[model samples]
Target chain A: MPKVTIDNITIDVEEGTTILNAARKIGGRIVPPAMCYYSKLKGSGGKCRTCLVKVAQSSAKDPRPMPKLVASCSTPVQDGMVVQNLTSPEVAEARKGIVEFLLLNHPLDCPVCDQAGECDLQDLSFGYGMEETATEDDRREFPVIDIGDKIKLHMNRCILCYRCVYVADQLTDKRLHGILYRGDVSEISTFIGNAVTNDFSGNMIDVCPVGALTDKTARFKSRVWFLKPMDAHRACGKCPGKVAIWMFGNEIYRVTGRKDQFGEVEEFICNECRFEKKEPGDWVIEGPRHIKRQSVISANHYEEMKKQSIIDPIAGEMNKQE
Target chain B: MKSLTNRSKVVSNKQMTFWERIYFPAILNGMRITFGHLFRRKATVQYPEATREFSDIYRGKHVLKRDDEGRERCTSCGLCAVACPAEAITMVSAERKPGEEHLYREEKYAAVYEINMLRCIFCGDCEEACPKEAIFLTKELVKSEYQREKFIYGKDELVESPDPAKRVDVSKRQTKEVLEFKKDKRYKHNK
Candidate 1:
C-alpha cells in the first residue's frame, strides 16, 4: 500500500496504482482527466498527456518533487508522494495546453454531428480548453471516409487519442489499421483498398473521443441528447443481449451496449445488436431507464414519492398505490 | 357620424338654377354616372377562379421553411412561440432520433408545432422572432375550415416537405433583408 495526497485529500491506494486511479479513490473534484486511458486495458496510457499533474513532493527516498509535470495516468503512486491537480496552477495550464493540442485539427461541427451531445472532446474542451482558440491559422481537415458499410470516419474531427486503434487491436482478431504517420500528420487509416470488416467495428465509433468515427446507420440521424435510452435484454449466444434501446417516441432508433453513469459501455455488444436489431420487439423492456440524470418521468416519480413521504413513509419507499 | 360629403368638392355649394334644380336634369346626371362605370375595369375577382394580389408586407399565413436539403430548419427553440404577440404559437420539442435526420435539421425538433389560426393576427411576430429562419409569413392563403379544431395548424400543416421540389418556396415573399437573414450560414454542423 502507498499513500498519496492529491489536492489536500489524503488516500492510501494499493502499490503500483497510477496517480489517476489514486485520484479516483479519493474522488471529489480533483479527478484527473485522461482521454487515452482505458481502465480495463493494460498499458493504455502515456499517449495523451491530459492527466498531467505536478508532484509537489515525491517519496521519502527521492526527497524531492519531480522537476516537470508528469502524466498522472501512467505514473504509479509512490508512498509519501504529494500530487497537486486542481490546486496547482501549473497543472491546470498544462492540462489546457494538452486539450488545445488535441482540438487543434478538430472540426467544429457539433450541430449536425450525432456525437454533439455525448462527445468527450466537446466535454473536455468546455472544461479545460480556451474560450477562444489562440491560433488564427486554418485548421487541418481530411475528407469524410467510409471505413466500412456501417462506419463513417471523419478524420477532421479526430483528436488522435488512438483509443479506437487500441480497442481494435485488443478486442478484434483482425486489426486492419494503425496510426499511419507520425506527429501532426498522423492519422488512423486502413491498408490500401482494405475496409474495416471486424465483427465489433461499431465499438470503434463508441470508443472515439470525437465525432471522427461515426456509425453510418446512426449518422446525422439524431442528436445524442434527444434519444430516450431504455434498458433492454434478449437471449443470445454470440454476445450478451443486454443493451440500451434508443427511441424517439414509438420508433426504435438504434441499440448500443448499455452505458453506466460514467458513460462507459458495459460490454462490447455484437454487430448484430448494434447495426441490425432496431425494432421495439427485439428485446424485453426493463421499464423506463433513467439514463441522464434529469428524466421527465423519473423527475415526476421522484416528486410524487417525496409528496407521499410526507403523508405515508411506507407508501413512498414501497411505491404501493392505494 | 359626420358625412364625408360635406368636404367633397363634387357637392353643390350654392343653390342651383331653376333648370339645373329640375328633377329631370338630376335624374339624367345620375343615369350618365351609372353608364360611365360600365366601361371601367371590373373591380371584382371571380371568387374561386381568380384571386387579388396582396401587398408586399401583407401577412397572410404562416409557413415553416425547409432548407435546400428539405430538412426542417426549426430546432424547436420556442423563439416563435415566445415572440408571438397574439400568443398563438404552441410547440413541444423532441430530439431527432436516428433515421429522422432527413426530417429535421438539428437534434431537437418541434414534435408538435401548432399555430392557432383563430388566435393569430398574422402579425409576423413569429417570423421576426424565429432565430433558425424556420418560421415565416407566406403569401399562401390559409384554407378556410368550418370547424374550430381545423384552425390549429399542426406539424402536418406547419412543417415543410423533405423534398426541395415539394417544399413551399417562401423566399419570394421575403424582403431582401429577410432573404439575407434567411441565408445566414450560422449554426452549421459541418463546414
Candidate 2:
C-alpha cells in the first residue's frame, strides 16, 4: 500500500492504483472531474485532460514536484506522493483550459440535447468553462448517424474520448466501430457504415461524456430533469438486471444502467434491458435513485422515507384507559 | 387595576341633552363626508366600457414568442416548466423533420405545449428561465372563462402570430441592461 495526499487529505491505497482512483478512495471535492475516464473499463483514461492535477511532491525518496500538471487519470500514485486538485490554482486554470478545448468543436445545442441535465461535459463546463467561446472558426459538423437501432450518434458533440471504443473492444466480442481518420479530421464511425448490433453496444451511449451518443427511443421526448430517476430491476438472463429507469409520472420514459456519483455506469446492461422494455410493470421499482443535490436532475425531485411516529406517554396511557 | 397597554377607555351610559337626543348634527356630519366622496376622483373604471393603462412589464398572459425569421423559438427544453413555482407549464417535444425546418428554430420543438392559466401565479419565473428567449409575459390579461378546462391554454392560444405585424411585443419586459446583454457579441449564445 502507498500513502497519497490529495487536496490535503491523506489516504492509503494499493501501489498499482492510479491517482484518480486514489483520489476516489478519499472521495468528495478532492476527486477530479474525469470526462473520458471510466473506472469499469480498462484503458479508458489519458484521452481527456480534464482531470489534470498538480503534483506538489513526487514521492518520499524524491520530494521534487513534477514540472507540469499531470493527467490524474493516467498518473500512478507513489508512496508519500502529495497531489493538489482544488487546492492548486494552476490545476484549476489547466482544467478550465481543458474544458475550453473539449468544447471547442462542440455544437452548443444543449437546449435540444437529451443529455443536457445529466451530461458530465455540461457539469464540467458549468463548473470550469467560460461563458464565451474564443474560437471564430466554424465547428466541424457531421451528419447524425445511428450506430445501432437504439443509439443516435451526433459526431459534432464528441470530444474524441474513445470510451465507447473501449466498451466495444472490451465488453463486446466483435468490435464493429472504431475511430476513423487522424487528428482533427478523426471521427468515431463504423467501418463502411456497418451498424453495431452487439448486445453490449448500448453501453456506449451510457459511457459517452456528452450528448454525442443518445437513446434514439427517448429522443426529443422530454428533458432528463423533467423525468424522475428510480432504482429499478427485472430478471434478465444476459447481464445484471439492476438498472435505473427514468420515469415521467407512472410511465417509464427511458432505462439506463445505474450510474454512480461520478456518472459512470456500475454494471453494463444488455440491449434488451436498455431498449424494447417500456412498460411500468416490467420491473419492480425499489425507490427514487438518489441524485446529488448540486445536479439539476435533483431539482424538485424528492422521495419520502418510511414514516416514524412517536406517541406521547400520557396520550398512550389515556388511550389505554379509554 | 392598571391597564397593561395604558390606553384603556372607560365606558359610560349618560343621559343625552335635547340637541344630542335629536341626532340631526351626527347625521348631517356623516352626510357631508359621503357627499365629499362623490365629488372626488373615482378609484375604479367600468371594466367593459372603460380601460386602465397597464404597466409596460405587467406579467399577465404568457406568449410563446417567434424569432425575427418567423420560426418558432421554443426548443422545448423544459426549463420554464421546472422554474415554474406553480408547476403550470407542461410540454411534449418532437424532433423537426427535414421539411419542417421552416416551422421550428431548433432541431427539436415543442409539439404539445400547454399552460394551466388557473394554476399560474404570473410570477414571470418562466419568462426568466427561458434560455432561448422563447417565452415571455405580455401585458395582455388572461381572459375569464366559465369552464375550468378553458383555463388550460394550448399552443394555439400561447404562440404568437406568425405575421411580424401582429407579433406580441415583450420588449418592455426586457430591461435596457438585458437588451444590451442580448446584443453583446462576446457571448457565444448571443452571436
Candidate 3:
C-alpha cells in the first residue's frame, strides 16, 4: 500500500489503484469525469478525456514531466504522488476543448429529444462548454437510419460512444454490436443492416449518456424531464438479479442497472435486467371509469345481469319474488 | 326624434367639406406609418445563402474518428453505449485479421454498428463514452433524410481521419511494446 496526497488529502491505496480510486478513497471534492468506466466490467476504457488531473512529482526517473495532467481513470496511484484536481488551467482547458470537440458533431435536437432532461451531455455542456461555436456552416449531413423493429438509429445525435457494444459483449456475454470505421467517420452498427434484436437491447437506451440511441416505443412519446421516476425493487423477469424499475406516472417505462444493489464501484446490470418487457397494463393509467349518461341505469341490462348472477342461490328466489 | 330648432321645417341635404371628402390628412398619416417601416432594417435572414452563427458549444451531428495511421480508433470497447442514455447505439465485434491490420488499429474491431437517426436525441453521451475518441458530435447539423433507411450510417460513413495537429507521435519503445503485447499469448484468443 502506498500513501498518496490528492489536493492535500493523503490516502493509502493498493499499488495498482488508479488515481480515481484513490481520490474516491480520500473523499476528495474533485469531480472525476468518467465516460467509459463501467464498475461491473474489467477494462477501465479511459476513452473520454474529461477526467484529466495534474499530479505532482510523478516518478523518480521522469522528473521533467512532473505535475503533468493525466487521465485519472488510467493513472495508477504511486507513493508520495500529489494529485491536484482543481486549480489547473490545463485541465480546465482540456475539459473545455473536449467538450467543444464533442459538440462539433452533436445535433441541436434537445428541444424534441426524449432524453433532454436526463442527458449527461446536457449537464456537461452546461457545466463545461463555451457559450458559442466557431464553425457553424460545416455541419455534417446524414439521413436517419433504422436498424430494425425495436431500435431507431439517429446518426445525427450519435457521439460514437461504444458503451452499448461493451455491455453487449463484455458484461451481458453477447456479441451484438461494433464500430465500423475510423476517426470522425466511425459509427456503431450491426451486420447485414439488421436491427438490434437482443432481449437486453432496451438497456442500451438507458445507458446511453446522450440521445443518439433511444427506444423506438418510447420515442417521441414523453420527454425525460416529464417523467417522474419511482424506485421499485423487483426480480428480473429474465435474470435472477433484483433490478431497479423506473416508473413514470404509475407506469413502468424502463429498467436500469441498480447502483445501490451493485456497489457504486461495481455497477453491473445484465442485459436481461435492462430491457423492459411490455406488460398488459404497463402504460395504462387506471383512472375512474368514464360512464356515459345514456348507458346509465338500464333495466334490461340489470335484469340480464341478475339472471346470470344467480346460479343456485337464494337470490334467485328473492328475484323471482320481486 | 325630430329637430326642434328648424325655422320652416327645412330638410337640409348637406354637402361634405373639401377636407372631409378628400381624406388627404388620414391618407398622409397612413403613408407616414408605412414609410417608417421602409427605412427599418429587415430582420429576415436569407437562408441557404446566409446562415446564423452557431454557439461555440452548439451540439450538432456526429463524427467518427480515425488514428494517426488513418486507422479506425474504435476498439469496439462499447463504453459509448454505456454512457448513452438513449441506448441508440448497437455494435458487433470481430477479431481483426492479418491483412485487415491497416483498417483497424486493435485486435478487436467493430464489425456492425448502427445508430437509429430517427430515434437519436443528439445528447453527445456516445462522444463522452467513447474511450478511443472514435466517436464525436461535430457542429454539423444538416441531417435530413428522404428515406429512413438512408439515415442509418455504417462504419464506412462514420470513421474519420485523425487531425494532424491533435495526433501524438508514439515513441519507438511504446510502439514496440504495443506490437509485443499484440503478439503476446494473452491476446491469442482475440486474434
Top lDDT prediction, candidate number: 2
lDDT of 3 by residue, A1-322 (tens): 7777777777788999998878766552464655555445566447767678887667444444464578887788777777777666777787888788777888655544556655667767877789666664554547666665656677777776676676667645456667888887888777767666665565566556677777666655433333333333345456444444444445656654443211231244445445544342432222221111222111112122345436756765444332
Candidate 1 docks at the CAPRI level of: incorrect
Ranking by lDDT: 2, 1, 3
Using TM-score as the yardstick, the better of models 1 and 2 is: 2
lDDT per residue for candidate 1 within A1-322, as digits (tens), equals: 7888999988889999999999977764688877887775566778889889999999857869899999999899999999999999998898889888887677665644667656777778888899656775667767667887888887888777788888788878989977898998898888874788888777887777678888778754554555577889988777887888877677777777776544567787878888888888778988556533342213222222357667888766454221
Order the candidate numbers by DockQ, best to worst: 2, 1, 3
Best by TM-score: 2
User: Number of backbone collisions per candidate, in order?
Assistant: 0, 0, 90
For every candidate, what share of the true interface contacts is present?
0.08, 0.92, 0.00
Docking class of 2: medium
Q: Evaluate every candidate with DockQ and list the scores.
A: 0.07, 0.71, 0.01
Candidate 1's DockQ: 0.07
Winner by DockQ: 2
lDDT of 2 by residue, B1-191 (tens): 88999798888988999998899998999999999999999999998799999889889999999887788999999999999999999999988999987889889999999999999999999999998989999988999899999999999999999999999887778878889898877554565
Residue-wise C-alpha lDDT for candidate 2, range A3-56, written one tens digit per residue: 999998999999889999998877777789999899998888998899999999
- What is the alpha-carbon lDDT for the whole of candidate 2? 0.90
- In the order shown, the chain A TM-scores of the predictions are 0.88, 0.94, 0.76
